[model samples]
Target: MAGKSQAGGERIEHPFDPLFNEYSRVLILGSFPSVRSREQNFYYGHPRNRFWKVMATILNCPQPQTVEAKRALILEHHLALWDSVAECEISGSSDSSIRGVRPNDLSIILKKCDIRRIYCNGRKSYDIYRRYIEERTGREAVLLPSTSPANARCGTEELINRWSVITKDLQSQK
Candidate 1:
């Protein structure tokens, strides 16, 4: 949504809009975009990220290979996606390197969508939300194990199991 800056080798702004709609029933938050995501201008663009795979497995849908397909999969299933840090100085895509955080305004999506549940993609996102957005939104986000490749300790099947919680929300919407 804004220009990217590499000053001090830290990203200064979020590069894309949050994905959501009036009918969206669930909101998923990541801490921030990875370098690959920024380059592709989409969420979880890294090939090794297990987000797409875990989503497909839990939703019982085909893995989305294109940005358009990814959007379709999320929107069609009443899920919304966005990041917690709107502006941050970080070294590459390392969440631990993030600092000077300016959290996103979730009301932009919350006002438009009937989101019933909020899910954080990892501990970083959960921590950020709890620290910055939770008081403002008055909603607690469920922490899900990260699907990032860096989280090798949690395999895809385990991620699928943990992420399966969202399906109940989605199914209830139907």
Candidate 2:
């Protein structure tokens, strides 16, 4: 799927590597990186996005303010971060605009880590993962409400409540 690009004739590809380690027990997947996230080379780079806020609240930790802090948060919690799509054509930050989907090889992380549960951050991620990765991996991801600013339907309390499942599972493992 091709579309007009914001940068003349150039289409954007996913710009960052997946974040995971041998310690990762849970994998959290987004649809793809937004333009801002690509620029910042990190997941949830947009300041207005509530991903970090929701994560901080769920984990009872300070909100991550830097790339290092964000990495630390995920690593410390045995969480892995990645996107469902490895590469795609997108007009902007909109997930709806994504096309030419080439999904990430989740097995890279799956093989390296003992990931017990997989979680998708929003509808698109969940749908893609369900359609592609789940069948091959035999691991169905729990779909969580998006932390994107666009998803105004779920407020902080609701997000916190819904996202508690991740933390709950983490606790049970301990």
Candidate 3:
């Protein structure tokens, strides 16, 4: 949980493993885990965060309310989930407060999965992915409006519309 210092504050190391499997075809990355997520030891643990709802709407599945259900959803859709930052100095959950970022080595999932497409959940994540992972992997990620509660500018409907792209190719195949 303790990480290196940056400026005056302490950075926090990412505490969980990336979620994926050999069947994974799409990769979704966030900037970093929020404090609530860190406490819950799962992605998008904040109640107000709409990530699970948005994904459920796009995939035509019931929204997940528990970690087990969330994992099931990701596995069922052949999607991988992780964060762009392996560690960073952040004040609360604000992406703007992030500094001294150490990006995650996404090759853990990339090497194990087919991972046809990558999608960043927010601007910070998108920037981090482009700066670190994209060049190394030669895989460009699509930017999706964040489902974070902080991103109130994008409504639930808009998020679903934008996020539907993740399932578009799969839907066509079915």
Report how far off residue 27 is in candidate 2 (Å).
0.4
C-alpha root-mean-square deviation, each candidate? 2.1, 2.6, 1.4
The digit string of per-residue lDDT tens for model 2 on 1-174 reads: 334565433255678889989999999999988879988989999998899999999999999999999999999999999999987767678888776677888989999989999999999999989887888888879999999999999998898899999999999888
State candidate 3's TM-score. 0.95
Which regions of candidate 3 are displaced past 4 Å?
3-8, 172-174
Per-residue lDDT, model 1, residue 105, is: 99
lDDT sort, best first: 1, 3, 2
Off by over 4 Å in 2: 1-10
Give candidate 1 misplaced runs (Cα > 4 Å): 1-8
lDDT for each residue of candidate 1 in 81-156, tens digit (9 for 90 to 100):
9999999888889998888789999999999978889999999999999999999999999999999999989999
- Tens-place lDDT digits, model 3, residues 48-114: 9999999999889899888999999999888899999998898878899889888999889988878
Error of 2 at 1 (Å): 15
Ranked by lDDT, the better of candidates 2 and 3 is 3
Candidate 2 residue-pair clash tally: 0
lDDT of 1: 0.92
TM-score versus the correct structure, for each prediction: 0.95, 0.93, 0.95
Error of 3 at 113 (Å): 1.0
